[model samples]
Target chain A: MFRQSLAVTLINLKSIPQRPGMSIATIISVALVVGVLLGFSAMANGFRATVQGTGSQDVAIFLRSGAQAELNSGLSRDEVRLIEEAPGLARDSGGEAIASAELYVIVDGTKRSSGTDANIPLRGVGEDAALLRQNFELVEGRMFAPGSNDLVVGRSVQREFSGFEMGEEIRLGNNNWQIVGVFSTGGTVFDSEIWADLGVIQNLYNRGSGVQTVRARLENPDAIERVRAYAENEPRLNLDVQAEQAYYASQAGATSDLIMYLGWPLSIAMAIGAFAGAWNTLYSSVDRRTREIATLRAIGFSGFPAFVGTMAEALMLSAIGGLVGAAAVYLLFNGVSASTLGGSFTQIVFSFAVTPSAIIAGIVMALVIGFLGGLVPAIRAARVPILAVHAD
Target chain B: MTEDLRQDTLYQLDHVSKSYTRGKERVDIFTDLTMQIGRGEFIAIMGPSGSGKTTILNLLGGIDRPSAGEIAFKGQRIDNLGQGKLATWRAHNVGFIFQFYNLMPTLTAIENVELPLLLLKMSGKERRRRAETALDIVGIADRAGHKPRQLSGGQQQRVAIARAIVADPAVLMCDEPTGDLDRESANSVLETLQLLNTELGKTIVMVTHDPAAASFAKKELHLDKGRFVEREALA
Candidate 1:
């Protein structure tokens, strides 16, 4: 039976080249469906990777008790100091806790790509900011000097925004700042922001001794719960505490969730259309090979082999389509840089990530469509009467 | 019947009936028909259209079942077998030849001949060797690499014949094998059937309207209105 199926399947596949129009129709429809699905999935994966990669499990964020994000949160100087002095905080080599009281502000900037004004984040960090963020690296030039009106821009911001190069001056509020250096944080959300001295931004924004969030590194990963308990119970702090990883995970949820909710149904709808196209192609193929199939049965070949042969033809076509679609996505979209307004109302830059898992998922989806498309046609082929050879 | 005669009998049909439901009416194609066929004999069933000649061939090959009574092939009741079992029975015991030379167009002559051998458990090399031998026997070995469309009608029929006999079945059921062929091609096919019957000891039952084609068979039976009206011994 296995041999019979293999022979019949090979014969059916060979006939596909003779019916190029029908075969190409199936392949192209499946490719379009898989391509669209992979494109949107890669977008969501890249957004999630950029946002989530910005956070670390050992770092904890402190915000106002009801604030949903650091953008809307404000902590006074005393409250920030109280949280930094908490027992579970990790100290640096100088016996000072590795923590930063940071201010997040959205400022208008001209996009290099569109030449239109968009909100870009300006993050003000204290002297210990670089010490606290272990992933931060100065890629070019030097860091901003204290109280010097000097600003360092993220690598992505330097590439995507106007007037963000070294030695260039940009105005924020009533003050002018010099872009002194460029830094990268491993393709994270911080790569989309501008960094400056804490006192310089506080004086410009008029927020006097108040910052948006306080971030601290814990002595160990397990110390996160201790800090959370301390913040919730300590009256002087009056703050909400969460792991930096969880905070960024929550920040990424809105966009990724929207992509998933919209992309999945769109993919399913496209898959249904592809399935119908495949069904029509396979049905026409079976209709044309009716006599051939009946002859096989008449010559002592069973219906099972005929059914398997038809299905194998469809699956083989679908697998090819899947590979083509995945390759198209990888070539056209993978690692392509893009930006969108994030939960902080600031433009976040990311690249489309066509990961290996995404390609595998696309191929599996194509096979599923193929299976659904081929089922009824294969059954029709199997049930074809041997007397059909006598019909015409 | 003598013991020697009983030993040679391949099929015994007893009071067999076949009917079809066309629209709202039941049409009887064969009613209360009984027949016997012996081994190593080439028999031709001749009849007009709708005389149940092809119906008998379909029943003999297990492609169709009788509506009533018994059909015994080598003393095993086959009329009551289920579809799957009947398919298996046909795969192992019967070969069929159609009038149109129904070879898979995508397969070459040797591949088409290897179709039936695939149902058996054998290595691909063994199947190919046997298929080549069958093509050799049918005298189309030189055209083994050509597809059905690449060959002439006579050569295609020879390939179909090789496909049928590759499995070495118990009987060859040919339903109007020469009906679609020219006179020369029909004679060529008839000569091949004669060789299979006389030289290879294969029992063949062919249905044909051509008297010349039927004359090649050792025994000829005329069916009319679901019954055999006459029998002739061809010399």
Candidate 2:
């Protein structure tokens, strides 16, 4: 039976080229489905990589109670001093704590592409920020001097927004700010923020002798519990404490979840549509070869061989569709940078990632469509009546 | 005449009844039909469209089962065999020819002939050898590489016959084998059948509407509605 079915399957595949009309349509439809599916999921994956995964557990973030975002959080001068002195914080070689009291504010910017006004995050941080964000590097020019009206712009902001070029100055909050340095944070969301000295921003914006958030390098990742307990026990400094990675992960969820929600259901629906097309194509294939199948039946080829033949043809066509889809996504979207609104309501630049797992997922989806689509038609092929050859 | 043929009975149909459920209609094609076919005999079943001529051939070849009858092929009851066992029975003992030639459109003439041999546990080289010899016997070997569409109606029927005989089956059942061909092509196909019956000593049962085509057979049985009404034998 195995040998016979193999022979029948070979014959079925060879015959497809003669009637390429419907089968080709099925292939194209399935390809488009997989392409769309992979493209959107890849975008979501890239979003997660940039916005959520770049943070480390060894660093902790503190936000005011009931505040989910740094932009909406605040720290009093006393609260800042208290958290900075809290135990379980990592120390630098100079015997000072590796912590930074930070302020996050959205500032106006001119988009490079359209010259339209867009809001970008401008973060004010202490000197320890350089140590806490391990991948931060000044790619061009010099770092901002303390107690000066100088700002270091993120690489993405410099590339995407105008007036942030090296040595350039832009007016913000009634002060002239010079773009002294351009820095990168290894493709993290921080790459989209402009950073300035904490004192300069605190004075210019009249932020009331406080910051929006405090970040500290933990003695170890597990020491987050000690920090959280300290914040909770100090009622005057009642703040939410979490690992930086967890903080970013919480910030990353809504957008990536929305994109993924759009991706999977849309993909599955399109798959169902492609499955319909495949059903029509394969059924017509069986119908058109009715007499041929009947003759094979009459010649003692069992129904199982016919069933096997039809099923093999369907899978081959679907696999071709899957490969085409994967290739399309890889070529058109992979590593191509784009930005979307993040948890902070600011553009977070990221590149689309067509990962191997995404490709495998798309291919498996195509195959599932093929399998469901082919089942009924293959059974019909198997039961094709031998009398059809004599119906003439 | 039927009793005389029973002396070398290759097929014996006793009280065969056949019907079909077509949509809401129950179509009765044959009732209590009895017949005998001799070994090496070439017989033609002549009838109108609904006369159940092809049904008899199908039953004898084990392509179908009798509704209520006993079909004996060389004294073995084949009508009672299950579908799988009947398929094996048909593979080893029967070959079929059909009106439209029914050659697999994708396969070449030689490949179509090699189809039945795929059921056997023979080597590929031997299968090719047997298919080649069958094509040669049908005089269509030169066009063996051509697909069904490339061949004329007569040539396709000849290829179909080659496919049938390649398995070395004892019986060849043809249903309107030359119905789609022109007169010259039909005559050519009939002559090939005659040669297969006489030279190869293979028993043949063919159903045809044309008397000219029936003249090639040793005995012609004319069926009307359900029963055999006339029997004629000619040299």
TM-score, cand. 2: 0.94
lDDT of 1 by residue, A1-392 (tens): 77778888998899888779988989988998889989999999999999988888889989998898888899999998789878789998887889989999888888888999898899999887876665799999999999889999999998888888789888976789898999998889998999999888898888898999998999988999899888878888788888888999999989888877888899999999999988998999999899999988877778888799889989988888899999999999999998888888999999999989989999999999889999999999999998887765
Q: Which residue ranges in model 2 land beyond 4 Å of their true spot?
A: A110-118, A171-176, B21-26, B229-235
Over A104-214, each residue of candidate 2 has an lDDT whose tens digit, in order, gives 887888888788888889889998887888698999998899999889998988888889989987987567988899999899998989999998888888896889998
Which candidate should be chosen as best, given DockQ against the real structure?
Answer: 2
- Worst 10-residue lDDT window for candidate 1 chain A reads A126-135
Q: What's the lDDT for candidate 1?
A: 0.89
* Real A-B contacts recovered, model 2: 0.73
* Candidate with maximal TM-score: 2
In candidate 1, chain A reaches a TM of: 0.93
Which stretches of model 1 miss by more than 4 angstroms?
Answer: A90-97, A109-117, A171-177, A219-226, B1-7, B231-235
Task: Kindly report, for each predicted structure in the order presented, the TM-score of its chain A compared with the true chain A.
Answer: 0.93, 0.93
* Candidate 2 lDDT, B134-154, residue by residue in tens: 999999999989999999999
In candidate 2 the C-alpha lDDT for residue B205 amounts to 92
Kindly report which residue pairs in candidate 2 clash with one another.
none
